[model samples]
Target: MVTRRLVLSAGVALATAQLSAAKVFFREHFNDEGWRERWTVPTKWKSESELGEWGWTVGKWHGGDESNKGIQTSQDSRFYGIIAPLDEPFTQDGDLVVQFSVKLEKALDCGGAYIKLLGGEVDMDSFGGDMPYQVMFGPDICGSGNARTHVIFHYAPKNENLLAKTDVRVERDRLTHVYTLHVKADATYEVYIDQTSVRAGRLEDDFAFLPPRQIPDPNVTKPEDWVDERRIRDPAAVKPDGWDDVPKTIPDADAEKPAEWDDAEDGEWEPAQIPNPDYQGPWRAPMIDNPDYKGEWEQPMIDNPDFKEDPLLYRRCDGCTHVGFELWQVTSGTIFDDIIVTDSLPEAFALAEEGWARWKDKEKAMWEEVSKKEKPEMPSFGDEGDDDLDEDMAAAMDEDWTKEEL
Candidate 1:
């Protein structure tokens, strides 16, 4: 027989083992002073450089107030790229979640606040829009089509990618909010905004993961004699007598002749134009079920021979050793912090609860203060105290000011 203490000890050991197994594939709070050593910024960026000013600055501000530290954009119309290595390859298995926080300190007119997960160690110096990436996911607040989080997966040869059809909109205000993308091995995915699940669906259905399951048969075609129209003009119907007698226009009953009008000079000043009520549009026979109607001529669907199903839509980039951010910010001053990639939801949320949660309240209060300051104050009328003049002013103001304007 096993002793009670032995069972308790075994349970404790098991719990500890499980907790230890929960690992963070990659994380960068940028709070440490030695962040430059952990991450690499392209040295080829400058105002006169082809990549333009990579105006990225690492500092602390009360806007986000998370750890009093974060990476932010310092100038407008610039390219900012920062890449860092991951502890392990991030594949689509278990529960891969990419989470981060973004605060649009400046109203973003056009810019991307997204991160790219490249497949392997890439030439840091040449990384830009042309670089290949496995996953590019994050919130992007910009012009019309870019006010939501982008969740794109690299499909194949460079430049080929599929974007998630269902994405959640992000707040563009100066308050910090968390964005998370959770993808599983079974092809199902979920997007979260500020710790709340906003969208969830299967990757195959939500995205064009594969070619269509069925396609129109190329061997068949609609017959030329096919009556595709549901209704046709009755051949036996004829126009009623005097149908052409009704004119399209008539003299207006209310329109009076202009006193300065001269019939000889003002080409036919026939009373101001008015609609001819008696006139009816071209007449047509009452629509009846066409006897020869063969219904819609839709080509029959055939099984797509080229279509192939992929059960493992999520695969660990066997060599994806780094994650980076490469984007153009128009307004700039967008702070990014608390970035983490993991295979456990609890682990990801735990990190957020520690970093984001800690300063969210303070950030909220600060934004509220800013809003209070920036918001236009409403105009106030009338005196502070009620006096005889108040009643007199109200009465005097009751007079038609439009007619008495001085």
Candidate 2:
């Protein structure tokens, strides 16, 4: 019989091995005071506010997060961006997952709360709108395409850069929700919002992965002699003999000539015209299926030469050393937290639960509280401050201060 100590030792060893095998390439909760050490903010980053500032702070408390602090945008009309280098690069293989939480405290009229994964050779100091990224993923709200989560992968062909089309429109609200993108090695991708799967499909089918699988045969054309008509007029159908005999216009029975009519001066009198009841519209032969009836013709399909299979379509980025936020906000107050990139989906979800799930309810309650709170009454000009002046001066300046009365 096996000893209990051996079984206990094996269990501990298995657990340790599993932990070591787990690939958590990068993770940030924005909790540490030394967060600046991990993240870098560009010097040229700008805000459209009066101060023209970028308000990016860690350990920021807005009374909506479970933690005492999180990364938040403190002002309106700003472009806030910060980047952190990964410890290791992600190659184009295996599984890849990106997860994060976003809380829109302001009614975002226009904004992009998305993150970019940059390649190893990116210019950290000059990271801006013009900088190219390997992947851009997150929620973007603007105009009619509001609350759409983008999962765009960049592909460079010759001198042009194109993005894959994958947009999953999400519900717009001012509450924290977790957004996750899980891409498997089999070219399949799944998007999860609030731990619920919103989209899932093969990358090759969903995106413009390759040139179309089939194309219309170039040599074949619709021939002029093709008799493809399915219907024809019935030759047996004939019009009635009285068809045209019915007069289109007839004399009105109820109408009488004018009482004081002058025949010579007004020309020969004619009865007022009325619609003839027997009159019918034009007639044509009835239709019937043609004896040579043929079904609708379709252009024959041929194998596309440009179509090529990509087995590593869902693979991770190679030499992707940095991840960052590069976005524009018309009205700010968007908080980002619990950003993680890993090979395991469970780890990403667990990280989201720690921050987003724990505080979303309380954050929603806080929003409701502020919305329902009564506005404080404005102070009257005739109130306490007027007492400092003389009685006559106070009376002259005060008395409701209505412009019409003045």
Candidate 3:
């Protein structure tokens, strides 16, 4: 039963909702002082002097006071690895969902702001990118072409796939936004950005986890003499006389020599050439439908010989033990908070409302205020370029340097 209700506020809708039925695997609000005990940075990351560090803060702005807090990537151009395991291991016997909130407060260029679910023994000291993970869900933004939320499944005996579509972008805003991925036991999945679903489909149709049901027959081949052309030149049409003889350009008849023109000083004066109005472009015979056109040729399809349908595509997720963030960022200031992995949609909604929904407006207001302040003031220069100052720019210099040269 995969379901998502557009919950505006957790207090109003799910205030009495009980989480006992959901069997939560993990939840991290990061509001407690002992949050340091919840997450761990890899030993390799700690020893390396160049790696970025993590910090707990309320970020630039929020609806609440210091209570609104999350773990933030506090440095630039570094690789970070951290993980926090659930109490125990559990199979995907029912619906599995992973969701969280992220605020990309500054330059969010190239980075992996996603969360990973892994199942394995402890090697906390050495955990890094090479660590195997069962599932990875969240946004991965690089640029326009590579911005998207990924829902990956790492199944045993060879299975790995990024969420099946292209350009499934994430919320790239300075303010807070919730990202949720719900994978149902029924083999369908839904990806939500906030309360609305942006993408949803069957697991088989979306991911190439199973072999195709059909394929082109190997025994059958397209005939070499197949008349696949739909149209051809008209044989009955004849070329008009003197079609090629028409000049493409001619001297401007209206143009005249100036009175100061000198035949000796300047090469013999001649009117500039112009496109000949009477000239015809390269002649092409009018095309008529070919009587011998056999339409497009296609190889006959047959049952895929190597295909074997797995009735349990949903089971490919298996399960996970730990959820972590192993990412690389070019420029940091990304804050991650309010993480939860469970089966209850209401619980997810409850957390979203208590966290993101409540603080989003305040965050937006702070963002607007910051953007207004970030506007660059017109720097005064000598009188040379002052005359060239654009009216709008002179009044308010270009805050964005991308539009024109300085």
Candidate 4:
């Protein structure tokens, strides 16, 4: 018989082992002042002073705990680049999950608030738009038609070829919202916002993962004599003799010249033309069964030589080494925080619940409160001192003020 202590010890040991095996690439809440140390700014900002700078804050007004600070873009019409290294390069065999929180307090008229998962050796000091990344996930807003939540991944064989889906869009608001991208080993993917799934599809089926399975044989061409038209004018039908003679318009026979009209004042009067009721449209032979027509000719399909089936198209994910933000904002103030890169979807979701779900209602309440508050009435001209007035205007203003006070 096993003792109770032994069972307790075994339970604790199992839990410890499981914890060690869990794959968490990186997680950041930005709760500590030391967050500045963990992230790096691009070197180009030194020479190019016009570029935006990053600031840490809970925004002008935060919903909940002010301690939950996020990195925000602090300048308008400028570029920004910053990156942070993960605890380790994610190379293990597992699914890829990236998640983060964003707050667009200013509506983000034009800008990108996306985060990139960079692989290989990335020059942290100069990381910008040019640094090749393995995955990019987040929101980008520009004008009317250009607003969307980007879910893109690089094809390693051809870096230029990126897998991008066009379904999900950014949650445009002043509240903190979560964005999650879960790419599974079985070649399926999903994009979730605030724990609710907005888009899901099979990676191999949705994206151009490989060359098509079949194609038209290059050497073969459609025969010149092939009659592919399905319908033609009936040769037996004949046009009516008067079909073309009918006029489209004719003078109204009921019209009589006005009694006041004079020959000298008006040119020869003509009744206004009206649509001819008898007129049919242009004459044409009726369409009938095309008995001699061959069906649409298709080029003979042969097995495509270039297509090589990838049983594991989704498995091509090489993993990520660093998380970076490269952006250009016309209207600044987008906060990014609560980022996570992990192999476990549940872990990412848990963060979403804690970070986003907790603050959503409070933010909404705050927004409604501000919106309902009444604006203060503007004061009249004689209410107070108008120091900027010229000498003559000032004397006249003083006389008006004295009269009003009296």
Per-residue C-alpha lDDT of model 2 across residues 96-146, encoded as one tens digit per residue: 888887776554656788888888686676677788787788888764434
Off by over 4 Å in 2: 1-20, 45-68, 145-147, 157-166, 223-232, 244-281, 286-291, 374-406
| Model 2 score (lDDT) | 0.71
lDDT of 1 by residue, 33-111 (tens): 7887888877653333434333334332353433457778776677888788898766554667788888776656678
lDDT of each: 0.72, 0.71, 0.77, 0.78
Q: Could you list the CA RMSD of all candidates, in the order they appear?
A: 11.4, 11.6, 7.5, 10.9
Q: Evaluate residue 379 in candidate 2 and report its C-alpha lDDT on the 0 to 100 scale.
A: 26
Question: Residue by residue across 289-404, what tens digits does model 3's lDDT show?
Answer: 88988888888889988887666667644656788898898668889999998876677877898878876888788778767666444555347755543444333222322222
- Score candidate 3 by lDDT: 0.77
Model 2 TM-score (2 dp): 0.74
- Per-residue lDDT tens digits of candidate 4, residues 1-406? 4698899999888766655666888999888888889999888544577678888988765676889898999887889888999999886366888999998765576789999988888889888887788788899877555678988777866555455645476787667788999988888898998888988988766667667789999999988899888889999999999888999999999999998878787977888999999999898899987998889998999999998877657753475789989888876778998999888787787677787787788888886675454333322445457654344433322222222210
Better model by TM-score: candidate 1 vs candidate 3:
3
lDDT of 2 at 184: 85
Q: TM-score of the candidate numbered 4?
A: 0.77
TM-score of 3: 0.79
Task: Give the higher-TM-score candidate: 1 or 4.
Answer: 4
Give TM per candidate: 0.75, 0.74, 0.79, 0.77
Flag clash pairs in model 1: 91-316, 119-320
